[model samples]
Target: MEILRVKEILNEKGWRNKDLADKIGTSENSVSAIVTGKKFPKPETLVKIADVLDIDIRELFNPSKSVDLQEIFTKDENGNLKSVGFIKK
Candidate 1:
């Protein structure tokens, strides 16, 4: 799930990960992890990131309609692919 739009916003602002990291007093690796969704940021960190980017925190998330459930899938016992939205009764 490509939730965060940090990387895109960074590109738009002509800023690098290190630039944001320095502004927020964190390591570039930490920012990269957040940008890549490898690390879920703490609320404070998220606020700092939003502040640095001059965007509302809500802008960091993808709209619900924009999230593709098919992208989040897993295999079943029979090796059948199952989307996260699949329901079994």
Candidate 2:
């Protein structure tokens, strides 16, 4: 599955593959492979990537789901908690 958000973040930073490669001390081909998802970056490399991009490592991956923190859950009579829906904070 496509998990990494490298390409999207790179676009936001207005950076080319070469720029990232240089900053991370890797080759452009290596960066390209990571960007295309043909290869996954090692943990150390991921740290370097995050540092170069000036973002948290968690931000490098796509969020599996979007959750609204404003949604409050309460237990029903049956004792099952369920989302009542979103509410303004």
What TM-score do all the candidates reach, one by one? 0.70, 0.75
Pairs in clash, predicted candidate 1 = none
Please write out the lDDT profile of model 1 over residues 1-89, one tens digit for every residue.
68889988999999999999999999999999988889989999989999989999999887767433334578999999887764333
lDDT score for candidate 2 against the true structure: 0.93
Which stretch of 10 consecutive residues in model 1 shows the poorest summed lDDT? 63-72
lDDT of each: 0.88, 0.93
RMSD of candidates 1 onward, in order: 12.1, 8.6
What is the TM-score (0 to 1) of candidate 2? 0.75
Best by lDDT: 2
Worst 10 residues of 2 by lDDT: 63-72
Q: Best-fitting candidate, measured by TM-score?
A: 2
Collision pairs in model 2: none
